[model samples]
Target: MAKKMGIVALLLFGVYVLCMYWYIFHSGDGKIPSALQGTAADPVMFMSGKELFLSGEYSKIRNFLFFIATPFEWLIYFLILLMGVSRYFEKITTSQTKWKLLQNAGYLFLLSVFVYIVLFPLNYYRYYLSKSYGISTQTFTSWMKDGVLDFWVSFGMSLIIVTVIYWLMKKSEKRWWLYTWLLTIPFTIFVMFIQPVVIDPLYNDFYPLKNKELETKILSLATQANIPAEHVYEVNMAEKTNALNAYVTGIGSNSRIVLWDTTLNRLTDNEILFIMAHEMGHYVEKHIYFGIAGYLLLTLLGLWLTNKAMRPMIARYGQVLKINKISNIRSYPLFLLLTSILLFASDPVSNYISRYQETRADQYAITLMEDREAAVTAFQKLTISGLSEVNPPLLVKWFRYTHPPMLERIYKVADHEGQKQEIPLKEEQKK
Candidate 1:
C-alpha cells in the first residue's frame, strides 16, 4: 500500500511539473493597454522579446524546483522512518550517553548532516540557476560559505527548539503542544527583535546610507509619514545580487530601513522615495504585528492538529515505523513530517494574506508619494531586474505569490495617474 502511494505521488508530481512548465513558458504576453504602449523609438514594454523568453524559462524551472522542495523533504523524512535510520540513531545515542541533552545533540547533529547532504544539490542548483540568469553575482566560494553558515544557524536553532519540545513532551505528554505553542510566542519575538542587529550583519556589511543627501530626503519623508526613523542604512549587495530591493525590518529601537546598494544605484531618488514610502506603509498600518498575530493563530491550530494526529498514527504503525510513541526521540522525524505537510497545505491561505497586505502598502505608497510615474517605472525596473513574470499563471499566483503580479501593479498605478490627471481637467472645464 505504501509503495503504491509513493508511486502515485511521484506520477502526480511529474504531471504537475509538466503542466506548470507549459503554462509558464508557452503563455502569451499579458495585455497592455494602447494608452500605456510607447512609440517605436522608445518602447515601454515590461520585457523585450529576449527578456520575456529568458524570464519565462527561468520562472518555469524555479517554480518546478520550489514545488518539489517540500515534498522531497517529506520523502526524506519518510524514508528515514521506514528504513529505521532514525531508530538506529536513537539506539546509538542511548548507548553512548545516558544524558538526554547530550543524546539529543548527537542524534540531531547526525540528522542535520544527513539532511544537509541530501538537500545540497537542490539548494546549489537554485543558486546556479540564479547566477546563470544574471540575477546572482555571488561566486561559488562565497555561496558555499553562506550555505555553511545557514546550515549551522539552522541546526543550532533546531536543536534548541527540538530539545525543548521533547522535554515538554516527556513532562506533559497531553499538553506539550499547547505549552510549546506558548513558548514560541516569546521566542519568535526575540528572534525578530534581534534579527537586524545580531543576525543580518553576518551576511553583509550595513552602514549609514553613503548618499547623505538622499538619506536626508528619506528621513524627511519618514517625518512627513510620522515614522520615527533616525537613519537609512544601505547594505552592500552589489557583490551578491543584481536584483533591487529595500525593506523595513525589526521592532521598536532595532527597527531599520535598509536599501540594497543595487537599488540605490539603479533607481532615481523619486523611485527610491516611493519604495521607502511603501515600506513605511507596512509599519504605519502595523502589518508586522498583524502578521505575527496571524502566524501564531495558524501555528496554534497546526500544533493542535499535529498532536491529535501523531498519536493514532504511532499506535497503528509503531512497529512498522519503529516509533513507539510521540515522546520517543526517534519520533522527531514524524513530528517534523506532519508539520511540514501542514505548512505546505497552508501556503495558499498565508500567501493570500501577504498579497492583500502588499496591495494595501502599494496604495499607501501611491497616496504618500503622489508620483504615479515614478511608482510605475519603479515597478517596471524591479520586474526587469528580477526577470519576474509580469502575469504569472493562476496556480503559481495562488500558491507562490506574496505580492500582486507586476503587470497588475503597473496597470493599477498607471490608471491612478490617469485618474489624477482627469480630475484637474474636469475642474478647469467647470470654470
Candidate 2:
C-alpha cells in the first residue's frame, strides 16, 4: 500500500513539474516584451549596442530601456511567486499532513513577522525583500541589535568607499570609470582581508573547522594552490537553516574560505576540494577585477543616465512617489519598483550581462581545475542539497536563475570529463 502511494506521489510531482515547464517556456502570447527577450541578437541588445556606439550615449540609452522594461520584470517576479506557492501546496495528502501544513504556514508567517521586526530599523536593500521571501530568521529584538551593528559597519565602510570613489570621479570626471576601477582593486583586496574578521561575525558565529582529517586534506590542497590554509573557517550555518554553501571571501590576513557547517557535513572531501578549486579559479582567472571594473563602468554610466532621465520623471511624480529627488536611496523601493517595471518590459538585455558573467565562471572552473569527477559530484550534491529541480524551463533558466540549474551544471561537468555516471536514486526508490 505504501509503495503504491509513493509511486503515485512521484508521478504526480513529475506531471506538475512538466505543466510548470510548459507554462513558463511554451505558453503563447509572448508575455515578455521584445526589448526583454534576451535571446542571441535580441532587439534590445542590438538597439542598445547601436545607440552606445553611434551616439556615445550609453547612459541615456540604457536608462530609457530600463524605464520601459520595469513592468515586464515585475510580472516575471509575480509568476515566480505563483510557482512557489503552487509547489508548496502540491504535496498535500491526508488530514494529518494538512494539520502539519497549517502549522508550517503559521511558522513561516511568524518568521516573516519576526524578520520584519528586526530589519525595520536597518531597513536597507535586503531587509524587506528577506521578509517578503520568508527567509529572514531574525526576531524583532534581534533585528534591532543586528540593525545597529549593520548600520555602524555599513555606515563606516560606505563612507570610506563612497568618498574615495566620489573623489576619483570628481578628479577625473571624463575617465572616472577607469580611475574607479584602479581604486577598486585595492578596495577589493582590503575587503577580502577584513570580511572574515570584521563583516561576517556581525551576523553569524564562526569557529575553526573541527574535523581533523578534513581540515588536513583541505589545507594540503591550499598548500598546493599557494594559499594559506590557516584562514579556512567553519560557519555555524545550521543555527539558521539547512542550506549548504561554501565560499572563499576576502583577501590576505583577512582572507578566508568559509565552509558552512551543512556543506562540511553533506559533501565529501573531494567534493569540498572541487568547490574550493572552483572558487580559486575565480581568483586565478582575475574575475574579481573584471567584475569590479564592469560594475564601476555600469554604475558611472547608470548614475549619469539616471540623473538625466529620472530627474524629469522624479520631478513630475516626486511628491506622488514620496521621493524628494532621483538620488534618494530611502525611497529606493518605490524608485526601484518604478524602474523595475520599465526594466522588466526589456528583460533580455538586463539579464544578458548576468548570464554572460555566470557562464564565464562555469567555464573558468572547468578549464582551470584538475578534479573533473569531484566537480561533477560537488554540483550533484549542491543540487540535491538545495532541493532545486534538476531541470527548469529554458526561459526560466535564462532569465531568473543566477547559477545554471544544478542538473545543467552537473551535465556540463560530465561533458567536460567525457563520461557518463549513474544518476542518484531518489528517496522512494531506496525505500
The lDDT for every candidate, in the order shown, is 0.84, 0.52
lDDT (10s digit) by residue, model 1, range 226-328:
9988889999999999999999888878989999999999999999999999999999999988998999999999999999989999898777778888899
Runs in model 2 lying further than 4 Å from the true structure: 1-193, 314-373, 415-421, 424-427
- Residue 144 error for model 1, in Å? 0.7
Give the distance in Å from residue 384's predicted Cα in candidate 2 to where it truly belongs.
Answer: 2.4
Q: Over all chains combined, what TM-score does candidate 2 have?
A: 0.55
RMSD to native, candidate 1: 5.5
Name the weakest run of 10 consecutive residues (lDDT summed) in model 2.
39-48
Candidate 2 overall Cα lDDT vs. reference?
0.52
User: For each candidate, how many residue pairs have backbone atoms clashing (under 3 Å)?
Assistant: 0, 24
Tens digit per residue, CA lDDT, model 2, 185-238: 677667766777878898889988898787887777666667556756888866
